[model samples]
Target chain A: MPRETSRDNMLREKHGKEIDDIISRYPVRRSALLPLLYLAQREQGYVTEAAMKEIAQILKLTPPQVYETITFYTMLNLKPVGKFHIQVCKSLMCALVGSDQLVGWFHAKLGIKPGETTPDKLFTLSVVECLGACGTGPMMQINDDYYERLTEQKVDQILSDLKKTGACPLKSGPFMWPEARSAK
Target chain B: MPKHELILLKNMMTPGYTGSLKDYEKTGGYQALKKVVGKVQPADVTQLVMKSGLRGRGGAGFPTGVKWNFLPKDYKGPKYLCCNADESEPGTFKDRQLMERDPHQVLEGIAIAAYAIGAESSYIYIRGEFVLGAHILDKAVAEAQQAGYLGKNVLGSGANIQIYVHRGAGAYICGEETALLESLEGKRGLPRVKPPFPATSGLYGKPTVVNNVETLANLPHIVNRGPEWFAAIGSAPKSTGTRIFCVSGHVKNPGNYEVPMGITLRELIFEHAGGMRSDKKLKAIIPGGASAPFLTEQHLDVKLDFESVAQAGSMLGSGGVTVMEEGTSMVWAALRLMEFFFHESCGKCSPCREGSSWLTQTVRRILAKRGRMEDIETLKQLCQNIAGRTICAFGDAEVAPIMSTLQYWRHEYEELIREAEAHREKELPMAAARH
Candidate 1:
């Protein structure tokens, strides 16, 4: 068992109300584990060891249980990632639509392969399976946004725009929240 | 022959439709819920759905009403309704479109389902990657609740229904109903064994009904228009209603198209999707998502309904019609699909865990030009061993790509092996000369 640190106490204080709201959704506190993990990821870049311990403590489970759940999911990263985590869809539909070539193009331009963050920590390239934008294949998700119907030229433009303004110009459908777009 | 009417996607085609609750209500969205809540009994709602002949859209094609009727009438524990919005199938994106474009329609469907099943609380287990869709659903649910459509004696019917959106953390198996429930309970998405199906023992050991998003989305139309009207829309008696076919890969216009259930595959591909991209000769098609068996050009005229597609040696699994052209490599395609299944296997059972990994490595070896002639036989044996031996339908699904490809295109695999051997033979003398 890892000892509690001051950072854990700070996270608890910051997200205490949100954590309570998440726990209240389920009949069992243990069921709040995944949402709490997402909250922890939002606090930090990834699910750190201390955060897992804090989540386990909050849900009344052991650290090992939470760790097992984390390992099972591909999205819940155990280590730190870059600011813009670019996950290119490499499933059957996307691959057929040239996602493999898109990944290769990213590798050549970014000077980094899949699963590696750049020295500047601005980009992390990963080839993930099926983001459910099959019709608009060869898609990639940067942070919370999905950039679909991609070509090499589009990838070039997106990367340059992100490098310049910290945001990509292209916007595709099946958003995490289009309502937020209006709010912004 | 009357043209097939779009029920679920009617609002989607409306220009400048923002998928708002107001927009949905203007098109008569929650009128079914308003009518059914306080007036109609739960059993009557189930009967109406059964008579409408609506089946599950998330692969299995199980009758939705029959599934609802499975919950023991005598059980005293809290009944739950879980709307499965975790649409992660490789070629399937219909549910995502429905949720993102018309979320209130989906919620209205969920409310109706909750009323029919006597579930006071319902949850939509959306895919983790669908961040935008989740946010839209959150807003839609809140909007519906505020409008007296979802929470606290919904519409003054004395039926308190609360809907929550639960996001999954990027696991494909969570789309499986039992695994979905397990994940909703905040655990690893390993599918639970059957015989104790969700209707009896589910979600905190209570009676629960799990439904697909598209399946539930049809509830409003079925309730609004009578069951007879709904049934009359389909080309066939069994597969009654319009289905949104997601066409991708080598199609000129790759997108979701809503058509009657019994439309032909050729019509879906050429007529609706504007034919193949670049006028390339069509080689093969996976009529449903990655899980369905691969169909060749000979099966193009087959109907797109659940029963007809099954009769043609494939399933209308999620209606993800993935078209492949002549220049495309079948071996490479199968390898990529095998890679997906291998990565997604839940590892609860030995057969799927070992078999998917083994098949993936074998296909990779073949694609790398290192495969022997005997490897084809080994691949078939592995497929045989994996199917029907696992906890869920995943084992059978994982084998579909391999088995179907081998059945339809054995010569492609053989040709690759022959080319590899020829290349190796050419390299041997040069190696000896260098030495």
Candidate 2:
């Protein structure tokens, strides 16, 4: 946590134009901190010290200011994680409809629990707060896609598919309810 | 059942409407924006929204039109309107559906709001977890800009309205308006004190107006069909327009149901949501989102409006009706929701930061059969100290589950403690017998 191993700007060389454009969107330069942190994370799997320092320099704040913002958010990881990050919802709606069992299957198959990464670095599992997909309980968001209404079979299929091809074609929902009536 | 027409989500539930700009334009979207801009006085638009009696759909239920009027009339600098799309509350998915299915509806709504407030720019503060919804809104914004609906000189009305999509990095407290402003400023999402409430000074210290996703989405409708039309739909005198209730938990058909505001909770659960998921008797309901207190079976017949739900001693917050069946444990349920509050407390205030931890530990101990008889009293006391003691409503919201559950289901807590007591008695006697 010292400045002895300090690294330089990690994003400017690659994302100069994008970074300038993002900073210009706001009146205050500090307002671009969250977006830059996201870009840093996207470039690297997790937010590194160099990237944090780079963002601080761009936003014109001290390193601690950027570090504090990083710690406040749950999505910005401090360390590198697996290729497929599995975030299971553990809130009331999902819990009532057996999200616990979904956690259990992760234990048996991946041999990992929430907040853990598999030894092979292929998957990481976390039990997160509600993802606003309450109606579709027993849901997990892998990377960018949400895998909902999950069964053990579906979980198995998703895992095998991700392991083999790094992708799954299972139905991801933001599906609406009550069949949209024929436009009268 | 009488059919109440869908206002916000008319063709959204159907497959034909793609939510694209062209698709939205065809379905009479942005026509309201076209009709109003450069033509109607900004004051007149505000007047129409005031007359419609539309309230904030995001939990607090403040009047949408009245909130717009609070901005300083002649402030010369830059004012802003922020659309809150950070829908992370447990059991609430209504905003997510509205954004993904009808991006332009929300975009058009933002444009109308910006013109009314005389702001040249607006931002949609969406949550980080809504990857798909953000992508959809980003695409829709580009499409609207290309079609001359959102950029400078929108629809040739000489109205310069630009909308930006900003994403939050996973903080539940960011949903609070003050905290949301702070988060938007690239700072930690902490709630600021009131009295200089958001209307006067907000979002980098300007006259900022923050409206929820569903609340702003109603503007185009209010402009298109007269306020009298929307005013007559709901409970009428007060809570007007249809509310999209996100029905989850043990319901047979758990999804978003858009109905008029005055429907009975019984009609929503037993009829609209297709009853219970199983044959089990329904025991409890959280009439709003996670923040609302639990209402028992006796309260089912109460009208699902803001005033009536408040009269029934619970809020009609966020319209997230989470149903729980008979076999579900109230203590465990409260514990799950409590953990969510404790984890997302933001640690800015001591009472919420510290009190949530105590409440969660106490509730967990009671549920785990390690609770003392006095733990029930401890739980009640912690909840009392936490509510109304913070910078925002989160303190009050965090305590609702604990306080409300204890009120209606004290017997459940007592029963669990009784079991623990019996176990202790058996252990003490075994040691005595050994001696």
Clashing pairs in 1: A175-B132, A176-B131, A176-B132, A177-B132
Q: Write the per-residue lDDT of candidate 1 for residues B158-259, one digit (tens) a residue.
A: 998999999999999999999998998888999999979999999987899999999999999999999999888766589999898889999887888888
What does candidate 1's lDDT look like per residue over A4-118, in tens digits?
Answer: 3346555588989999998988888888998999988887778778899888988999989999999999988888899889999999899888898998998899988999999
C-alpha displacement of A78 in model 1, angstroms? 0.6
Chain A only: TM-score of every candidate?
0.89, 0.91
lDDT of 1: 0.88
Stretches of candidate 2 above 4 Å error? A1-7, A171-174, A178-184, B425-435
Pairs that clash in candidate 2: none
Q: Write the per-residue lDDT of candidate 2 for residues A1-184, one digit (tens) a residue.
A: 3332334864898899999999988999888999999998888778888888888998899999999998999999888889999999999999999999999999999999898999999999999988888988889999889888889999999999999998999957445665554332
TM, every model:
0.95, 0.96
Share of native interface contacts recovered by each model: 0.69, 0.80
lDDT for B349 in candidate 1 is: 97
Query: Highest DockQ, which number?
Result: 2
- What are the candidates' individual DockQ scores? 0.46, 0.63
